[model samples]
Target: MPSTTAISVRNVSKKFRLFASPKERLMEALHPFRKQYHREFWALRDVSFEVGRGETVGILGRNGSGKSTLLQIICSVMRATQGEAHVNGRISALLELGAGFNPEFTGRDNVILNGAIMGFSRKEMLRKLSEIEAFADIGEFFDQPVKTYSSGMFVRVAFAAAIHVDPDILVVDEALAVGDARFQRKCLLQIEKIRTSGAAVIFVSHSLETITSLCSRAIILENGIILADGEPKIVAEQYLAILFSESKGEPNLDITNERVVGSSANQGIQINQLRDEQFCDVDPSAWAGSLSERFGYNRHEVRTTNGCAMILDYLVAGNGCDDISGVWSGNAIAILVKVHFSADVNQPIIGFELKTDKGVTIAGSNTFLAKTQLQPAARGDTKIYRIEFNTPLNEGDYFVDLGVAEYDGSPGGYVLDVRRSMMHLMIRRKQEKPFFNGIVDIGFRFTEVDC
Candidate 1:
């Protein structure tokens, strides 16, 4: 292993035996022929990977896809049946709820016990005790036995202990999912700090949003095999494709690579610069065939349709233009979508959402949420929807996702057609020294008052 490499696995594989009954096992064990009576299940098959120091790698897979198995092997909780895994530094793992803790020990005592297991002196643990307690924020429970703690409290203390150990490699296996939203965010931020501190982090989660936003690299595992590994966004898309196929019980593993469906002839023309009135004046026939020919189109857009309806075109407009080259923070912007239906439909809904380049959705809304009533549409009918909302976003590049669905008496409804990240644009600060410090500008006011 190289000096910069924190973890390396070569041809790692694990196997388990399943026996139906103890009589069959005893017969097989006592037989002179030593006949096999158990079926073999391979949890991992020749899986190999390398994690350079400071790299955050996310592992995504369906349940029982060897994600936890890989982490367990790396953490030395389980031995691999074949192959070898090398680690260059101490490891801190939160592989499961209350994994390394003694259920009889109090939360405070458990931290001290974990410290000793990691070769830390009791004095050192005591020095870090306050920080862990503050981060966990489970008041009173810190003095109570861990067995009495709720699942959320369990994770808080577990995560707090894991992160404070100063391990060279951190392995987290869906433990953060047990925490509430606020605590989950806190853990993610702490993970970022650890990654930046030159620790290799192995994260496993089913949430694509968390994976993309946090990991610099991602890996997809299917049936104990490494299927896709590379850019977080691309790997996430592949994972989604596999999940969709599995949901339908399809045998074929057909993955579609979607490309930007526009042209380069109009490259010099910035679409967002067009005036709103001009957009209103243009005939649908003028742009229907050339939507991909326009500028500002996202090359990674993924489109899926149910053959009932289709979105022909869309535009983003704000700040005195029908389309926006750039939107200013705290300004009003309108998303216009033109959709056509090929079959009779009742209560069609149109919606759009804004997402960061990393795929974190900032805001989204639909006509149903807005309580807009729409008439039923016959075959070969078309309609345009104008969705306007204020932009309270900080300066950053964002993607726009649009969808048209028919009401199916469900929260998500039935997706007739949906476009993922179809539009790309930047949000700029309207003035220097903007008040917001994060992705969103929720609007805060302050005033000096006499004491």
Candidate 2:
């Protein structure tokens, strides 16, 4: 019978001893009866989670948050100082670049070596060697020593080897970030295949978008403890809130129950009001031009700073209409932003970005980039900014992120308030156009030359 759980981590904790000096280490080894010369540092404190068959769980945290340490423990590369972790199936982990390969050994030899470590016989390794080589796509480097390989080449081989072995649990620790965009997409597809095969995956990445798109669930780790676990969207928001708080030297906000608010701004706009009210009238051309457009609102905002400035609300609507659910490709749309200033600011800048559902930014513009200058603003002032442009996106779901910052005679100066995933926009196929090839559909003239 097959195991129901792919991974089980129970109250796992890892502790490392910190020695003051080299002499302290020797002193402690020489005299066991004396007081210990080292202090204990806990990297993980009772971190507990489980992954079942066919489930993918994303691990997210800032640096020094024990994400890597936890992955190492799960892969059995390091043992926990307390508690226990059990793996029900064979594991293939890509924890670090060139972690398992011997520098002196050729890629071919390393492949066989890794397979042996995974309990495959020599014949079985040879049978799968061709498939691994083709997947890696490293031409002559397969026969050369791994030490001679670049970082990208090294990861290509390591990733190919790990996935080809058909492990029950896959643990990828930010390894895909090193690969090029094309390779990353290929790897994501392969991960999807593995998931389809009923294998559990534990993915650790700093890209919240990746976590949100790929994993059914996500957990946020902070200072070696599990801070939040549930939907990827909620967890990512909590993580961002904590990051913003830390950057501003404020107390960490509980994002679950409370909204992040500025210190001075009380009796501000309510969430429902922001959603229901029309900040501005839509352009006439936007609604009059397209009859196939639909529009709805799904917005989320996080105040990164105190009450210096606030983005009250924003809207993406078709021409001449305040309400929109979706828009056709190549149609005209307008973005309106309402901002309130509580403190005097010099050279305020506002911007917007349109990103694909996969979190890849396709196009965006800001005031600084456009060389637009605005007058300085004082407290209790409100301003409305509008940007109208034709949509260049293909048929797909996209997100709108808005930000407000103050220019300090520098590029991308101090950010005041930023909102991510503020609204979801869907782009549909236009009747006159063919299928677009990439994230954007740039209508260009075409010509062909006969050879």
Candidate 3:
């Protein structure tokens, strides 16, 4: 049976009148003939989606992509110009900073006031007050006016109050990103608890990892319309690909033209052909004439000094042996790295590292780590190395840094060629399985012990 729908939005659109000045606003309102003094701006257009009970849905988009406007409409903080949103149960929302709290009021007072707004009586709020305080962990700031609180503190108190009220639907709008790492982890745990308790969650964030780790489904918004909606990983990848294209001053890749490469007879040869196409596209000599010319330096971020070998190209291929723009968690994928030798070298090593946008290394591997030996390469020779495995990663944008070096018979080695931000990888959760909490999805097994 299909899950019960807890939130439904139908053909929802919002339009605001942009007045040049206060006089224009007043004139427009007073004009009996309804003379237009303001231009109309549509924040949302024909957007529709449903969130089932116990489901977590992520909204991904660029800034001003109508994400916040859609959230405000769903929370009823703002009304839609057309269409309707039907919410089945009480909602607790942490929208913009200081959204439900008065800046002049003490945090304690705001908690009680917000609780009352959520339909809890004063006594009932008092019963939950200590739990809220403990969760917020603001210490003496709890007694201070909200105006004195930091952005992080504001999020803490707001999140603590919203979650403590026992809402059937939770709407969070990039608020958790304000908190510190430890607190963010705590909030994620609480969100998981809420999901377990059957409360639907609507999360909006620029952080793809957070979205893919928490939400089972995701939607991508562009120009006030639903661009894509389905698996969190795919939607996130579409958003990133748009970003990548725009960064290079090119039009977004037409994902509609792409199809999943299916497994068939002669899959290996078909995959090899696809890989060849990928490699040819990234060839340095072809950079001036290839399709990559339109996307100048889309994959070129090289860093090397006194280098003897250089990475000529690389490819990220999906299960069907086709180059993929994005990949999903637990899906089989492959990375092919091709290197060109400029000088003879002994004990040459090739490796790759996956890093977050913040430059934190999540995982990496080198040929030395794998204890693999390869025949020495001479000048004018090229070799290809491939690694294939199932990716156990959370959804987010990641960078692949490729490097080639010669082992110096110790832990330290001489770097030959290294490229930072050489390739962009997007990983999204494909299943509605429980959210994984970390960067990697290490499938851990447990065994019972009896004494």
TM-score winner among the candidates? 3
- Residue 35's lDDT within candidate 2 is 70
Candidate 3 per-residue lDDT over residues 417-441, each given as its tens digit: 8878766666655446556777787
Residues 2-82, candidate 2: write the lDDT tens digits.
378999889999999999899999999899688799999898999988889999999988888899999999888999999
Residue 154 of model 3 has an lDDT of: 94
Which scores greater on lDDT, model 2 or model 3? 3
In model 1, the clashing pairs are 262-292, 263-292, 263-293, 276-322
- Among all windows of 10 consecutive residues in model 1, the one with the lowest summed lDDT is 264-273
Q: Whose lDDT is greatest here?
A: 1
Which candidate do you rate higher for TM-score, 1 or 3?
A: 3
- Look at candidate 3 and give me any clashing residue pairs: 233-428
Tell me the whole-model lDDT of each prediction, alpha carbons only. 0.80, 0.76, 0.78
- Residue 308 alpha-carbon offset, candidate 1, angstroms: 15
Q: Candidate 2 at residue 391, lDDT?
A: 83
What local lDDT does model 3 show for residue 383?
A: 80
